[model samples]
Target: MTITSPSSEAPDWPQCAHEADGRRCRGRPVEPYAACLAHIGVDRRAGHLAALEPGAGLDLRGTPFTRDLLTELLAALTDPATGRHRLGPADFEEAEFSGDAQFARVDFTGDVSFDGAAFGGGAYFTGARFEADLGFVGATVARNVWLDGVECGGGVCFNKTRIDGELRLETGTITKSAVFRGLVVGGDATFSGIEFIEPAVFMETEINGTAWFDGALFRSDVRFDGARIAGKAWFDGAEFHHDARFDSATLSEDVSFNGTRFVEGAAFPGATIGGDVEFGGNEIGGDVTFRKATFQRTTVLGPLVFPRLLDLSDAEFQSAVTIEAAVGTLHCRRTRWSSTAALRLRHAEVDVSDAVLQFPVSIAGRSHPFVADGRELEVPELSDAPVRVASLRGADAAHLVLTDVDLTGCQFVETVHLDQLRLDGRCPLASPPPGLRRIGRRPVRWTRRRTLAEEHHWRAERQGADGWTRAPGNTDVWGPAALAPVYRQLRKALEDGKDEPGAADFYYGEMEMRRLDPDTPPGERALLALYWAASGYGLRATRALGWLLLAVVATVLAMMLWGLPQDDPEPVSTGTVTGSRVTMTTDKPDPVNPQGSYGSRLSSERFEKSLRVVINSVVFRSSGQELTTAGTYVEMASRVAEPALLGLAVLAVRSRVKR
Candidate 1:
């Protein structure tokens, strides 16, 4: 087909005006021929080839070549010295090759372009050198395309192309952007040490074999969203200057992003990894998310410096995984770990709310740098913040272990197996509000105790008060009846750990809950109230001793007023003349109860006698003193109640100091 300009006559330096597939040729005409050598008649093509020498510059822009025609052209440019076709400043933009285009080891001393080109068979440019820009935008290769070790001075574009077989561009440097958007390789794709100076785009690309991108440097943003790799992908030691995205991508085999530096953030949300994943030694400057991603094998993600968040919300891990990092936040909400997992973090806030753990999982706070797998991860010096667990609501904690993690704001309501959960080191829980408070002019002092965040929220909501902070994202406030068992189980766990002192606070919390529980029977509730008021459920030594002292004083006063006598009575003899004999009779006046002068009855002498009687009653001994009916009953009651109070005081002391 021929395409001519609008002018009636061809101007000087006339254009070839050749066209095919809706694309017009831009090649210049050959002397003594109307069209360029590629578009000239079959008979004249031999004469043009005779005039061309090896390593000659060739421009066949928009040419449509059959298998025989391309073979003849390449044969004319064959260099005898290296037995390889050599070209200079070659341009095949918008060209169509009807058969296998084999240009292996072809050295182009200047710029080259196969841009918008179509090859019916395999296109080989292996070990070739393009001193300038290399373009293959909108190209289609029916079979494999090899450009392995092909160096380009400028940008490289294979954007929106398809290759039926393997495509390799290993160890090639592109000074500008490396655009491969919407590209598909039916076989293995290899890209190693390809220093992409500008943004690299591989969005919606698919590779059938191992996608190797090891040691690559992307000076700008890179994207790989909607891509699918059938085999393992390695991006070890790769660095991205800006953000990198692999959202919605799928990898069938093991993938490694170790020692990668993402100057900005990196995201892989909704991606699926069929095999193991290794993502250690990374430096991420912004937030990195793997939300909703699925990992089929063991995954290790950390030993890195993450300045911002690492979110794995809704992600699924099928095998064992370990993460050790100094990150800002690690969000694992709704994440499911089918096997064992370990998280050793520093300066990070973790939220595992609604997460499912099928096997044992441990979350620990590291104060200093730790060595893992023979490599020492460096900890940031500016912040020694502990790993704070913000929430564990709805989590199955049957096999969860926490070590030195701060839980001051962690919500534990609806958590499963909370009683069986293991806590090691200083796992700090929230403390009750400080100082005494009043409820409607009644002085109320809460026992200082470590409590859960859910309890705090419940109390605040129940009282409609403001001092207590509510848990984030938690609107369901449990009543004391529901919280009582939670406190009881936690207390039991501490007791089992031989932490009696630590368990003391939990015991107090349990009793408080029981006392406030509306569902408790009246008798039980009243009993709990008395237990608290007397000795704080046998955990308050001072309260028990105070009640004991009050009982002793009241007993002494009762004896002084109603039991001590006014004075001692002496026996007298009386003589009667009833018969001829003199008879002597002895009469002892009964000891009278103290009466009339209240001041005399309350004298120091009477007080001394009353104190002796009261002390004897406390020890369950008889004072051998006379008493009124009321005083007798008072002494009996004091003997039983005072000793019991003393015992409670001693029990409280033991509970506090026990190991």
Candidate 2:
């Protein structure tokens, strides 16, 4: 192991040709020996170990060291003041350790490189501090690797490394960026309480054991895309100052992100979670997306405060999921829920368009804070914040329940099981425009009715109507024929809930659609038109009453002009007939029609008679007064028409006030 000059007779400098693990050693040979000190025989290694001094730089690249040999080298570099190995600049690149490598509490004042190194047994660097960058690129550890409490002033890289046993970086701090891309850990890996000052990349990394990242701080962006964790992954209390991407990652066991904070945004698109998941008590400053992700077990995704959007579009949940978020927008379009789910939100605009709901799902508006996982989460300061639903279009709503959710802009046209949807609390829908609006040349006053967003879009597009704003990107406008059934189903739902009064408006809407539907039969459409014009389909009491009053006035005027006699005739003895049988016969004069100068028929006496006759006709009663031939027909027509109008008015009143 002694250093000596090469022979002057040699044509070129000789290189060590020792081979191990199919790789030939390329270290410079010792002058007295054919191989470097690391690859030299054990009997000849004493001189190299004796030559090493504390704080010395060691270069063992491309060398192979046994456990005993490595110990002797480290012992030679041990500092007397601290009784610990103090290395200036250690380069172990392409080095192979045959047994356990112990470097615990070792201090490397200068840069350290273990790149392409292979450790046959456990490698310990616990409590070690590197003043500069620490590289483990392409390194292989056959057993556990302990890096707990290690501090690195510069960036740390474990890129493309493989650890067959446990890996611990707990309580470690990296001042610069940390790269773990394509790293593989076969046993449990702990990164708890680690502080990463710069961006951390873990793309395509695979951990077969439990992954712990609790209390980790990532000052810059962090990525774990395409990574696979076979066991549980705990990221509780972790903070990410910048964006965090976990796209296409796979977690086989329970994963927790509780109490985590993402200052920028986080994404998990196409990720798969095979076990239970906990995402509560999170503070996300920007948008968070889990689009197309799959959750195989129960998941609790809330008690979160999201300042921006939370997109779960195209996601699938195989088990029950509970979400308690105060997000700005929750997009769940095309999401599939195989089991029950609950959404307790505040100040969120939820869109569940085209979602597949296989079990009961409840979307409720929560005013108070949420208590989850033994933690009390605070809500936003906006006390009057409302949870509104943007759309239910193309959703199967048979098992859907809504509680205190605002549906003012919800589109229900393509929703399934609308009649079975349960609406609890004050689930408000959009109301039609107030007051009268001119449609074409005629003044049309829309009835105050709860309507769907699709209906608004349809009407707005059809008539260029005001007071209805179309939803963004919503180009599908349902026609009256399609909207008619939606309104009818909703009306039935309200009626079943014992909210007949609330159902009245929906019934009115249904009738309106039927009247306007071009596909409706001509005879049925005409009847519906008449029904609406006269009494608003038995839902507008004022309209019915107005028509009734007009009918009464017309009947009174007709009776005075032509349906009343000018005067009454007195009885007189006329003539004898058939001798004794007709000795004294009584004769009554026929009532005569009113003569010309019709204004005279408007006398107070005649008016009194006309008023009495019209009043009798309203009640389907005869006045028993003499009348002209035309007056007979007028009274008969009034008897049939006036009573029917009065009945319609009564029906309208009942419909509005029914319990």
lDDT of 2 by residue, 13-50 (tens): 35566767665565557656788776677667787677
**The candidate that achieves the highest lDDT relative to the unseen native structure:** 2
Q: Candidate 1: worst 10 consecutive residues by lDDT?
A: 1-10
* lDDT of each residue in 1-659, candidate 1, tens digit only: 12222233433345676777665555456667768767887779898887788878887765666778877887888899888777888877666677788777777777788876778788888877676777787777878898877777677778778788888887877777778888889888888887787888898898988898888888888999989999989999888888898989998788888887788888989998888677677766778898999887757766655668889999999889887777778899999999999988876889999999999999998877655456755536427667899878888888788999999888777788788778899998887777776555665666677987778888777774445666456367888887887888778777877888988888888888888888889999999999989998999999999999888888888778887666655667787776788788998777777778766678888889889998886875777776766777887888789889999999999999999
Q: All candidates' lDDT scores?
A: 0.80, 0.84
Residue pairs that clash (backbone atoms under 3 angstroms), model 1: none
Question: Where does model 1 exceed 4 Å of error?
Answer: 1-43, 50-166, 170-177, 181-188, 372-376, 379-382, 436-445, 458-467, 470-482, 492-501, 516-527, 566-591, 595-612, 621-624, 657-659
> What's the TM for model 2?
0.88
Q: Model 2, which residues run further than 4 Å from truth?
A: 1-32, 38-44, 80-83, 372-383, 417-420, 436-444, 470-474, 492-500, 517-527, 560-562, 573-584, 594-611, 657-659
True lDDT of residue 18, candidate 2: 71
- In order of appearance, the predictions have TM-scores of 0.77, 0.88
